[model samples]
Target: MLSTSTVVITSFRNVLALSVLIRVGLILYSEWHDARSLVKYTDVDYRVFTDAAQFLLHPGPGSGNRAQGPLGEGYGDPYTRETYRYTPLLALVVSPNDWLHRSFGKYLFAGCDILNGILIYNILLPQQTRSKATLYTALHLLNPMVFSISTRGSSEAVLSSFVLLTLYAALRDRWTWAAVMLGVCVHWKIYPAIYGFACIAALAGGGRQIRMMTLLKARRILWFGVLSVSTFALLTGGCYLVWGDPFVYESYLYHLHRLDHRHNFSPYFYLTYLTYPSPTVGNFTASTSDASISISWLNDILESPLTSFVPQMTLAIGSGLVFGYHLPKTHLPFTWFIQTTLFVVFNKVCTSQYFLWYLLFLPLILPRVTMSTTKAVLCISVWVGVQALWLSEAYRLEFLGVNVFYRLWIRGLVYVVGNCWVLVQLMQGYDYSYVTRKYVESK
Candidate 1:
């Protein structure tokens, strides 16, 4: 008879094959069904990426550009108005799209999605049963949202893969590799930098056993910090050399001071709407003559986009410090999830895609939690219900041309409150001791 291990291996191969087949089908459907029809399923961001790639391939002077994209420097074709708001490297990575099929980028991201599934399985295999590992891999691989985003040419899957790779490296005690990966991830998307403190603490031996000054002096910690910063600086500095100041402003600075007054899932939306010009209500500037003298000072404060970053960064950094110092290595994934949840919830701009940041770490921590199924369902319901509520109001505002900024902002508050409640429930049932014991048992 064949060995049980052989059977499990075969089953895993089968699962991976099935995932590839499913992704291929999704890619084909996205190209023909979505691309041809008026009802679009693919994200519009793909065009922006390709346009940037084309521009990079064929350099041109800045002239006759009208639609100043997020980059604010219209370097691409004058006719195309799409903006590319990422690093020059990302555009170069997808530059093949200009020559190859338009769906080339989608294929690339799909491959990353598959790689993420493999990484998920490997990360879990040592801690859980083979079947459990396979299940988690399948859950991530076959997830509709995950595949949908990847097939739509979003770089989120690629971003997520780098994050998982960092976690995988950290779990293996390859601190240097973890640091490098984390740095690359942050360069890819700025939010991953928040995990730096947790990573540093992990490298320096977390908990009260080590003094603060001693932790700072540890060689491994120093190397991790140095390599991470060096990697980020090298990549970003190199890009800046090529793309210059506009690249810096568009990619990094814009997001830092970004305040979209449009209808979105942010509690600060109404505040931004009141302070900035509203396209929804033509010729309406709430901060102008319409505003009373009593609240003019408040509007001035809100007018500065940096004002929102103060509270957001303070909360995010505080969470990182607490989790890094208090949590064990086994709890790092959960730590990241909570930190990301807080970051996204407290952000000046929250969107559906932002959910992927925390969702990437959710499966890693779920198997360790001692939560009951019913309670988990309740938490999920609350989370999704709040999103649905916000989306309904947002749809009315964006599509139906209704001015429901106040209602949408209120929904945003409810979403934030609901997410906090879910986090508390998850924390209560997390079984931190269980994870620590598992780590000890494994050792």
Candidate 2:
């Protein structure tokens, strides 16, 4: 009879093989279904990506031509009318898909998911048993959000792969590599810039130290800042040189002034909607085209009394400083998880794709943390459950032509509450023993 260890290892290998096969099979199915459709029922963002790629490869004044101006007007093609808000790097990444079918991009994103799974497994190998690491990898591969986003060609998968790689580099004490990867991620999407502070905090040693040690820490932080900024400048500056101000305006500034009043997953959406309810069209309801509605209330909130900028900046900076200070006192992986989570929670927009930013890291940290399996499951379930409720209301409004703003607002409130509760649980359950021991040893 085989020993228990041998049997366990064999079983794990089988599970790993099966998981890969299933993921690949699902991806192929999605590609096939999308290809066979007469209308091509993929996400609109995918079409936007393809259109941007086409325009980049063949600049023209006809169909799929690039648009200009703040509203991104002046395009014959509706899809291409809105300028691509993502970095030029994403356009370059998707440019090759112009020759191939759109499903190819989805395939590439699926491949990214696979790569992320592998990275997660390897990242955990040093701190976790092979069996536990394998299980974590499987959990990541099987996550429903991962499947939904990757199959739909969302860039979150690619962005998340960069984030995991950055974390992996940081854990290995490869600060330069971490900085480079982070710069690349920030170029792809601006949100990952928050993690840079976490990286700096991780590198900065913990505890009240002597003046000389403080100086050394300051020097190291300065070095990291220079490397990261230089890397970011190289990538973005090159883009600026090539594409000029339009790229900068559309990619960066547009997001800053974005006024998305649509009923998405954001709690802020409810506040905006309640303050500035959408006007009813003849028989239809509030939609994107109904831009005639007055946004004076939102404008006032953003510009007067307290100014939205003040609170947003304060929350962002305050959270970063607090997390950075405590990061050295908590497990790196868990603290990174909380840092990303808090950033999303405090963001101006919290879409489903945004959740993918931190969900991919859940399995890697969950296995290493001290949180009980039951509580972890409960927390994840509640988080996902509230999101589902909000999505249902969104589907009703967007797809079924039903006006459910009231229901959506209620669900959004619940969703926000659920996220806050989960965040609290995560903080309470985080394992600080590693950092505590390190501090003790240093002293």
Candidate 3:
């Protein structure tokens, strides 16, 4: 029989080889698909990056031709046209793609995804046997969501890579690196700031007695906090100095005013659609009426200040407190996952890509987590299945103009319930001894 060490070595080699093969296949497939031309498969957000780079590289003659200045001054679609919604750091990151083909951006994202897989593999090495570690790492590399996001040129993959590096650094007790990585991620996208409290708590050490007093007393925690704040201030202040108020407004303040009742998959979207159904629902012949109805619904939702804000604020605060309560009680990795998952789940905008934020952390904790195999399979299935159903509804509205508005609330409810179930299971942390027994028996 092969020794355990030899078996582990073999598994590691196999995982590395398979990871390369899968990534190469995805790259080739993306090239063949020509995602840049296909609107459905292509990432619309990527266009913003490339467009901003083009504008910066070659400025237009007059103000009219100055690439809309990131505030969508005269453009049709503010989101894409006023591409300054993101921090200038991302535009600078993608500027090189202007000289190369647009497809090169996709390649760069793919490479980052592969690097994330390696990071995950290394993080798992100390906790599990080599075979198990390799398998967990493969789960991240082979995830469909990861593949789709990386190939389509969404920067979530890059953001997630940085976030994972921060988590890994924290796990290794490298507080300074963790702080630096977290600052880098927050600069890329502000949402990662949600993890700030959890990082501080982790640095302060885990237990029931952990409090503000305890955290303040720890020299390492104080330094970490200082470095993190300094990093964020430097990056954001530099952007402000360079581009002025437009950079600040578009990058940070715009999100506060985002009311996407018409073209979004949030539960809030369904709530608005229910209150005001499109005319297309009743009269299929009136295709033009759909836009007017959607606009009316959006107007109502936005104009009534409390309609959307109240519920979102309530959920945000309530879920945040709950996650904070459990942060010190659970393991750091799982705590980080819970914190991120709750943010995505309860946020006003729950995009499909946002799921990647928590999903990337799942593999790191999978080996340490205890759960029945059956329940694990059920949770995974329902999570992906609900997303598929929502995608279908979105497709009907976007492509076919079917206006499946009436049943949207049902889908929203189902998605929320499924997410809650999975989250509960993860928090419970059931023993995996039975899962191991079942596997051995089957073998």
Candidate 4:
């Protein structure tokens, strides 16, 4: 009979091999599909990423002429589906794709997916049994959504690596490394920075009674905050110096004020679509009674992307205040998971890829959640059911060329409400008292 250690080792090895096999198989399939068809199966974002990489590898005065960004600026061309919207540094990271295979970026992201799985396992190992740790890691590694996105050449897997690394470092009390990793995450995608407050709260010894002045004065908090801010500044500032205003606008500001009306998953999608200015019609809405019915005032009030920021900020800050402050380092993932979910739910522009922002932390959260098997399965089904409902409408709109805007909008509302209820259930099942007891024991 195999010893416990041997069993543990065998389990780890099996999961690791399974992870590699799954990712490689999907990566090859994606590459093959893309090569065989004019209508590629890989994300259009992959094309943009490769174009940006090619531009980086061969920098020339004419580089700007190759593609135009969403704003008609260079380095990304929406017409060709090459709209590079991420930081230029990401382009530089994948620049090797110029000489390497076009699938190189996919491989890179897949590798990060593997690394993220390892990180998640290590982060949980100290608090969980070896068997449970391995299972949780397998949950992340074998997650179909994660591997599919990475194999399609999306960078969310890479972003998740940094996110998990930051989480791991914070749990280990390596504030400097955590800060630096978080800075990289923010550089890769701006949304990850929303968890900064949670990290600070964790560092200052999370608890509701912890005074604001105490957090402000905590040396670790100060160091982590300063380093994260400085690292982000240096990276963005250096990129700005090299790439100029277009980089700044596309990578950062564009997302801040993004009002994308197409292929969105947010509840606000229809509103954005209706309010968005059209080149031919402009912002005017013609009423049946009047030829010139300017609803510009109403549009301005309801349509401003900044209006979404109010709720998003409220959720972000509120999550930190409520969960982050109360949870110890052991439970930080719960704080992050809730914060990201709320942010994406309320954001003016959301996409399917945005789901990964919170999904990466779900494994860490599950170990402490007290849901029954039936309840857990029910929650998962409801969450996935709403997504399927939205996707059915989306398929009609995108593929069938049918106008399902109202149906899609109604589905979006269902999606958001379903997700919120799921979150509530998850929170209710979480062992908050366990976290409190752990903290008290440590004290």
Per-prediction TM-score: 0.88, 0.81, 0.79, 0.88
Q: All models: lDDT?
A: 0.77, 0.68, 0.67, 0.77
What would the per-residue lDDT of candidate 2 be over residues 333-430, giving only the tens digit for each residue? 66567667766765656777777777777876675457778998999899889988888888887888777776787888798789989988876776
- lDDT of candidate 1 over 1-443, digit per residue (tens): 96875554447787788778878888898878875799787788887888877776664655543223434354443223245678777777788899988889999999998999888887787788877778766777877888888888898888898999998887776778889998899888898998998877665555546556564448777898899999999888866655666677777887876777664677787777776644335433343444563386776787776677777777777777777777667678888888898888888888888888888887788887777789989998999999999999888877887767777889889998999999999888887664434444443
Give the runs in model 4 whose Cα sits over 4 Å from its true position: 1-10, 62-82, 208-217, 279-294, 435-443
Worst 10 residues of 2 by lDDT: 70-79
Q: What is the lDDT of candidate 1?
A: 0.77
lDDT of 4 at 123: 76
Put down candidate 4 lDDT per residue, 1-443, tens digits, no spaces: 98875565448777888888888998888878877988776887787888877665553455443333333334432222246778876776777777878788888999999898888877777777777888888778888888888888888887888888888777776778989998988888888887888888676656545556564548777888899999999887777656666777787787776767657778888777665566222223422342232477766777676678888888986787677666766788889999989998888878888898888888898888997889989999999999899998888878886666777889999999999999999999988765433323332
Alpha-carbon deviation at 179 in model 3, angstroms: 1.8
Best by TM-score: 1
In model 1, the runs with Cα more than 4 Å from the true position are: 1-10, 61-82, 208-217, 278-290, 435-443
Give lDDT tens digits, candidate 3, residues 320-400: 445444444235566667667766776656777787888888887677668778988998899889878877776776678
Backbone clashes, each candidate: 0, 0, 0, 2
Which candidate model has the greater TM-score, 1 or 4? Answer: 1
Residue 68 lDDT in candidate 3: 43
Please say which candidate is ahead in lDDT: 2 or 4. Answer: 4
Error of 3 at 46 (Å): 2.5
The reply for model 3, stretches above 4 Å from the true place, is: 1-10, 35-41, 62-80, 208-219, 272-330, 430-443
